[model samples]
Target: MRITPKVSKAKAEPPLILAIDIGTSVVRTMVFDRLGRAIEGLESRRSHKIETRAQGTSEANPDLLLRLVWDCIDQTVAEG
Candidate 1:
């Protein structure tokens, strides 16, 4: 006779809220609960650089920044 172990499914979690932060050099996203706590294993971020010149001017690609934010948010949402 042979014996096998059984596997169990994970329990459902409570509802979560989405949070996004855009900064000068990076964008990030995370899921949080009502208590203002970030949920574990549900965060994403992307690094970016600001364009600068010798004249002390700086800027970044608006479209690229938007896409990075969107991608991180989408990934975090799918995690919860």
Candidate 2:
């Protein structure tokens, strides 16, 4: 007797667009459907301390900010 492996099909998800914003102190992620409306109850934000300079310049680590943006995107997709 030969046994066959069963393959599960992937479920179709609604079209979504991820809008990301990187600010000096926060990174925000939001998901919208084709209708251009935010999916209810689905959003992500990452807030971190920024480096302040004597000249009133504020900045954040590039690598850290990129990772935070990715994190927010991932969370938004998962929740939406």
Residue 55 of model 1 has an lDDT of: 97
| Model 1 C-alpha RMSD to native | 10.8
What C-alpha lDDT values do all the predictions have? 0.75, 0.72
Q: Find the candidate with the highest lDDT and give its number.
A: 1
| TM-score computed on alpha carbons, candidate 2 | 0.68
Could you tell me how far off, in angstroms, the CA of residue 40 lies in candidate 1 after the best superposition? 0.3
Please, what are the lDDT tens digits per residue for candidate 1 over residues 20-69?
88889889997766555566767899999999999999989999999999
- Report lDDT (Cα) of residue 65, candidate 1: 93
lDDT of 1 at 40: 70
Question: Per-residue lDDT of 1-80 in model 2, one digit per residue for the tens?
Answer: 65423221222235766788887778998766655656655679999778999999987788898899889988977875
